[model samples]
Target chain A: METPNPNIKMWQGNVACAEGALAAGCRFFAGYPITPSSEIAEVLSLRLPKLGGNFIQMEDEIAAMGATIGASLGGVKAMTATSGPGFSLKQENIGFAAMAEIPCVVVNVQRGGPSTGLPTHAAQGDVMQARWGTHGDHPIIALAPGSVRETYDMTVKAFNLAEKYRTPVILLSDEIVGHLTEKVEVPPIESLGLTDRKKPTVPPEQYRPYEMDSSDIPPMANFGEGYRYHVTGLAHDETGFPTNNPEKIQAQLERLNRKIERYRDEIVEVEVQYTEDAEILVISFGSTARSVRRAVINAREQGIKAGLLRLKTIWPFPGKEIEAISASVRKIIVAEMNLGQLAHEVEWATRRSKPVVRINKINGEPITPNEIFNAIIRQD
Target chain B: MDYLYYLRQDKMPHIWCDGCGHGIILKSILRCVDKLGWDKNDIALVSGIGCSSRTPGYVDFNTLHTTHGRALAFATGLKIANPKLHVIVVSGDGDATAIGGNHFIHAARRNIDITMIIYNNYIYGMTGGQVSPTTPAHKKASTAPYGNPDEPFDISRLAQAAGATYVARSTVYHVGKMDNYIGNALQKTGFSVVEILTPCPTSYGRRNKEGNGVDMMRYQKENTIGIEKAKNMSAEALAGKIVTGVFVDKEQESYLNRYNEVIKKAQSGV
Candidate 1:
């Protein structure tokens, strides 16, 4: 008997993100209408409300983020999606979630921009921005998906990491992945490893909102649950009150950053293909990663000994793996949608700037395999 | 009548000046919360950094005093995590319209069920009275010492256009009217913005001699013409003016409502 292939269906990456978010128990979505990422909000806006969830078309990206935060506190998994301009608007709030140690997923289907530079075009310019745009020192998790299938998978992963680590997680997709359609098979929701925010185990009177136990992440309790505490951006002690004391500030700040950095083993993820005994490594992420892999295959067919290291998670740099691969490879060519956002990170990781080349593109199009191959050829 | 008694002692008298409109707005907010007879514990007051952003500390609730220009962003996360709690965002003029302008518009556009109260005292009161996006043109502030070269923003109109399900404007002087607006904004099912036309008595008030806190209120009372009344009037009559009232009130699918719809669809599909 011949069994029909079940995973054969077409859907845009944005739709996959919505479906994945729903599977991740996201019942709230607040976002504005922006390019590429709009479909996630569009699908979720119609989808969430039918499931006893909430959806709000916020006044702007800032308020969309605020509304999402409010709904999250109301005990629903919440998210919002936007592009470059909206992502820039969301940095402060993202920092707020980081300091407050609140868990939520923010999807940025990145478009060209320093400031709305290109609204409808794809760009990977936000890589550094995603890491440090917020005005504070705190660790962040950013996942980049290269395909529509990965969009579904990574969205679930983004929410999972957010809840598990008690931090905001960014799904750093680009316009290509956001708008492109592909076939994806989703497993039953019952089989998914869903994580919810940890609630306080102690009595309300004994609850300390920022007090950590064994885990650096403190147990969370929603408002109306009688757990009263303060959350401030000013460096604070475990009690969550603002303090300028050097020791207290250092300890608090260290804990906030270390909570994610120390757990990089669990947070950092990369997809390596044929890196073993290779002469050149193609480094890329998001939609451009697909092109890099194809370039690697094309290079290999020409007996160039090229391989691919696709970064599924862009933050925490994946420095160790890149370093290890760099030690074995003859050259590392970085391909991205921007001029050279990831190239700098790649150079730092390898510490050999000459062999590390950047295939830069800012014209609002995906970097092609031919361009990446040409970069490698130029170096050779 | 010492309503200040309700404020959280740990946060203290705060950074507002003697005649700052933020104080009046804060008092009115507290009064609205008090009049509602809601449990303080049930309130999760969230704010972004700025003068008015300090409000979460003055009240006894599960407060999240977040970063600048991002209060509404954090509020969105909080509300979605637990939709049952009353999530209130208190923000300043610059914090709401300048750095946080994106969030302000998006929160309204999303119509997420949350209440946003902007202490629009015109100037950025806490930061030595700089000209904010909401600061009226030709007004003087630290940044606009020669005179505010930029035109001020109409926050209420911006929010109304941005898709807030409930939108209104009030001032520190109209404490009772503000309370009603606040209550309605909070009670509404989607995003609501109550632009409290608070007087920056120290900044906006002092430079313009808009009087002290008392004069600030009187100015609001005298200057504000109702939106309904202005609708029949000419633009010339309403020029150099702000019309305040419930400018928008309507119902559409809220974020949560739409979310539940998807869940139902998924359930039925399953």
Candidate 2:
């Protein structure tokens, strides 16, 4: 076993994300430079070749996404990083990966946008987009990291979920977390739990690429592994050939959906602080959660029963958990850097069980702790 | 080597319409692979959306039928990840030049070690006779009901200018030469493109009063001028003629080779 690096260093979130991907055994990265997210690509370009990995600056975001998926299918952990405009261009290929069940990670450093709204500034605007950006009914797994350290940790987790579920996973970090520099302790690589996609155990002749045996995920075969099988964006049967039959299509869609749905417990993660006996819950994620955390502390000092529920895994939305918290809390104050994207999700999850309030900021700025505190006090 | 072994026999009766030349191009590719005696296991066939893209489903290899025009992008990733595996991207004209135009030029510029075979049948046959990037100007298409207003792209020249190491053009009518070109492309170390002008009889032929597949084949044979022969011909003589043959062949370090050099340099801490 290799000894873990017991070194403490100050690093930016984007740099941490690159280091995290390297530690997670990601061997391929294809990306086009985009603001806020470009640092991740820049760091990986310098670091990957040294580690015997490959990195290519593709011509566009579509090709970047396509290349990452291809590298994953070719038996390597692969990733791409982009901001809003680039992320929009990647939607088609993202859908392709989702349909073909390719394991890859896409890191979108959120910027304000319907179209390039803010380049260097932060916004949690892509929350709903991360869940529904790709035009399809396929399952999605999105993780939001609140700090530099979490950016590093969640990048590794994103790759793990991608490999585990045989789907594209998104690491949705905003500009604040992406560019923020903080001290983080580097742990040993071995101590980090890693998951690789399962390969076919059967003989090459008997192997079916999409054949499932009790589990929703089928063992994936690499391109040069001798087990030649077809992969397509079209709905395919167990043999991995496109099928138009309604029953087969339904079954295939169900299997893709259930792979993430059935494994929701393992995929969905949230951090609850002081919510056990609190009357008000401040639900937030990514960089916005940083301010919410400080606000919760400030609210407690002011004699208000306020707590924070920070979401780490945003998609496969922790609806049941939110519902449970809503049953106890009198009101849910969802604070974010967008126009109440996740707040709407919280409201839908609560179903009027508790009143859900939104404290949104979309002027290309981070939500301050005082703003969150003010919202909390106003709710009281 | 039995070429049949490289086919998914169970998926026989492919979706291509009668007289479609995609099958001929596909067969030529298979024959070239057979001629080279490559291990089927070490080959990966990739394609974008169209009649040509469906060829991967019938071929017995690790095949990827990707989104429209993204085959080269996907194949680039696959080839770079596993340099030992031979990657081929088969695409249609529109799929390669329209939506995927950026990838095509960029892939050529990088000179990645992948074979790109474009089955340019002039029209988008699968999409119900729409005009494509290669559809000749004034040709009738569903979108261009009166006539196509846009000029066609010279795919081989486009690739050559974009820095491909090996670039060639052939028609489905010239099956033997098409096979040879494909084989040469597969053996090349850098980006190689073989743009074969296949016949879209059902969509393009019937609409343009081109008689049938046989007439289109005859037209290709009669109108195509060899590169060498066309060099001496007058501009007027070569105007309506299809100039076919190899346009570019030069040796250069491929993207993978250059990347490997970087890996070595980095690993040695130099």
Candidate 3:
């Protein structure tokens, strides 16, 4: 006896992500075409113009990323989407965004990698790349969505975090989730609570772009807003100019990490299901989490104690969450579509305390529920 | 015009070596902006990595010093997202033609409203004078000790071929002409490129025995050919001569204007 929601519709993961970005006040998108994530650019190309937003297909992924950062500094939310190879091409600009503290979102629809391993396939190979891809000790925010609806929600959350932290956030979607179809009820655009970067409250002449306050994040003034300032990829001081002084360099580098580390509680997110008395724990993420849920349910039905811990935020890695839940669970299993990418992290998070087993697949396919369920039933 | 009004005096003395013509090209830009009466806040001086890339930091505009060879890419986004802002890109021969060649041609093909100042100093002055794409054949650079093997690029011609609405070239020796060309490029409403043949005397001139900065400026005065005079010259006569004049200037649909039409059409839902 429930009323049918008129907004409910069948949406693909990539489509939902595009709609999510629109709903979250993302007005600029510059991207190149690649499999699995191409729909994001296609949908935005048609939708953004109608919404008075900007959408452009740049010359390549490097330009796409560069534009995304530029558009963000131009005082609008911007994003770009690509597969594995394109993602690699975007790293230098991504590092630029990190160093300059520009607010933008980068979507990496995970395909198999290490030089185009599989284009139209599911793989979590770029998980580490998403964290350390940009060749520096800068902070990052990356979220992996497990299903169609979560893709939409996480896409919104990704933008919010980007604005909140003044850093680029990665919407890490795999080919499986990106292509999957499921029911989604999109909230009205006005109803969606979106976050914008904090604007400078001081007079334009007195504004400093990187002057950190008590909140650790400085107000970002838009370009052409009368607050003329400098932004550089080099190590810069609070005034936002390139500086090579050792003391100033150390302070600026520390402040970049401090801004995110101080607020890790607000940034990290995860989901735990049925772990009250479970003896076996399954750690999973992205599309693999969808299959792991099914296997966990089957393991319970077969009278084995099994529960699921799904990672929503991939970096800053939720290591504390694993350690907190380690006391009760005797063993932990990581299931994914790559050859032990997150498994390595799970082992480290547990600090060699649990018997961590990995169920990895590198083929152009999703990890099957049977494969994970069989792992749960087997002892040795 | 008072130069200090546009410059961030606190950031100077600048890192440019004595007699390096980057300062000359920088003055031309400042003069052009002053003549136009454009608000400093409304201009974004974006640059990629090079000695010329440091031009943004010296000015009181919304400056962005980006990575190597990606200034055009960044400026494209800044302009498209906010059409009200005037985006100018400052790059060098290596930054513009070598590492940034792909973006250069594509930005021209799109015909976006960005004024590019290509300071063709013939070598990588910031990274210790490696041979750049514009380094003349048989020129001595640090990497080209036995003389450069690459033919130089005619930047103004390249811009004309790549669909730029305005293209011009001048050398630091011709300061008045450089300012005139920079002013004309700034007034245009499409992709405009002004290639300035400047000297990197400390690295490039010292290696090639071009004498000092004064000697290099004297060479530019002697070797370059004005476009009008070159009309009657034979191919062999113009082969080694640096042609300095307007190559292309015309009206065309800029990328922003065309994209605005797309937005209007999309809103109409026809």
Candidate 4:
């Protein structure tokens, strides 16, 4: 293992993401260039090969996703980075990785859009899409980072979660945090807590690729490991063959969902600051959380008690945490770049116990601290 | 006699319909593997969505049935990640030429060390006879009921043009020849393509004027001309006939080989 360099240096968010993936033991990267996310690909292209890892610039986003899944199956930690339009194209293969239970990481450095709305600007419009973008009821884990340093830490968390759960994890970033340059301290490789998927314990003849024990996460046998098995996107039995049996289908779907649901507390992470005695609570994530912190500080100085709830794990939506905050605060303010996407989730979790107000921006710009401060002070 | 060792006995009664030629192609591939004496664990069978894609289910090897038209893309990743493992992709006409057409050409251009066998039945068999990219003009399909107007793609020529190091074509009736071609493909160090013209009897035969499985076999035997013979035949005489032989065979560095060179250069800090 290489010694950790304690030297602090300025780095872009996307560059930090690539460094973090390397620190987390990602050995294969397949990506197609898309704005606000290409730096991760560009840096990895130069860096991965030197480390004896592989980097492939695939023909398109669809191929990039496919290649990442394949590399993961081959017993290497793999990842891909893309933006809005590319993320849309990757949905089908993302669903494949979900059904096949392949471990991989996907970083979507979000740009504005329903379709290429703004290639170089910031937007958190993909929050709902990240959770339910792929067509199915499969479980997904997505992490949102608030700063360049958090981008590095969350990317490492993303790979660890993906391997521990044996599923694909998404690192959701908007253009603001992705492009922002900040001072980051590079941690030693040994300091990062890296996790790998559990390998099967049985002999080759008795191995079943998807057979679950008490943990619900089946051991994944790598290809060419002498335990030959089949994997498919079709609803399959524990033996990993296509099955249309209603009972088997129900069991398979339940296992996929429950693996994450049962361990939601461990998989979900959030940053809660000054919320214990505050009357007003601010809910924010990703690049917008940076401004929300500033807004909360300014509001507190104006004699209004305010706190910020920054979501680190955006999916498996920290409902328990939100419920506790809703019970304590008088009003909940949700600020994001998109038009009230996460606000609806806050409302759903609170069950209307408190008023949930949304401060939305959709003109391809980051939500500024001043804008959030004004929203906090408004009487309505 | 020991051929059954290659199969997963529990997954018997494969989903391929009776008289379908996918079985013959699968058997030929298995024979090639046996002939080469490859360890089963070292081979990864990959496929996309089609009747032909169901092959990975019956074969007792590390198999992946990926999304539609992306088997080659997936196989490319598998091969690059572990260069020692042999990756083979089995795809149908529509799966290879329509949805996955871009991946097919790109894989060829990179010359990745993968053997891709295209089962060209000229129609989308799994979806009930939709007009595929290789569906012959004037053939009736569910999607093209009134004498299809689309021209078909010559897969062998297309693969050769796209830079596959080894390219060959053979029909189901030419079983021995297919085994030979597949064996050669497996031996090649770069991207190798073997286009197998198979029969989708239930979906394609009844819709066209072709009679039955046996009749389709007879048509294949009668319509295909050897490449050597094709050289002497007039253009008008060989217009509808399939030319069966190797189109391109040469040595070139594959994607993994070139990538390893890059790794060495980058690591040297030169």
Backbone N/Cα/C clashes per model: 84, 1, 0, 1
lDDT of 1 by residue, A235-348 (tens): 777777777799888877788888888788888889888889787888899989888888888888888888889999998779988888768787888888888889888887
Report the C-alpha lDDT of model 4 over A128-204, residue by residue, as the tens digit. Answer: 88999999899999999999999999999999999999999999998999999999987767777899999999998
| TM-score, one value per model | 0.81, 0.98, 0.98, 0.98
* Model 4: lDDT of residue A186: 79
True interface contacts reproduced, per candidate: 0.85, 0.86, 0.81, 0.75
> How many clashes show up in model 3?
0
**Predicted complexes: DockQ each:** 0.48, 0.89, 0.87, 0.86
Off by over 4 Å in 2: A1-6
Model 3 CA RMSD to the hidden true structure, in angstroms? 1.4
C-alpha lDDT of residue B216 in model 2: 89
Docking class of 4: high
Q: What is residue B57's positional error in candidate 3, in angstroms? A: 0.3
Better of 2 and 3 by DockQ: 2
Candidate 2 structure lDDT: 0.91
lDDT of 3 by residue, A88-155 (tens): 99999999998899999999999987797788888998898898988979999999999899999999
After superposing candidate 4 on the true structure, give the runs of residues whose Cα lies further than 4 Å from its correct spot: A1-6
For residues B1-270, write the lDDT of model 4, one tens digit per residue: 376999988899988888899999999999999989999999999999999999999998899999999998888788878888999999999999899999999999999999999999999999999999999899999999897899988888989999999999999999989999999999999999999998888999989978888899999999999999999999999988989999999999998899999899889997
Candidate 4 has a DockQ of 0.86
| Candidates sorted on lDDT, descending | 4, 3, 2, 1
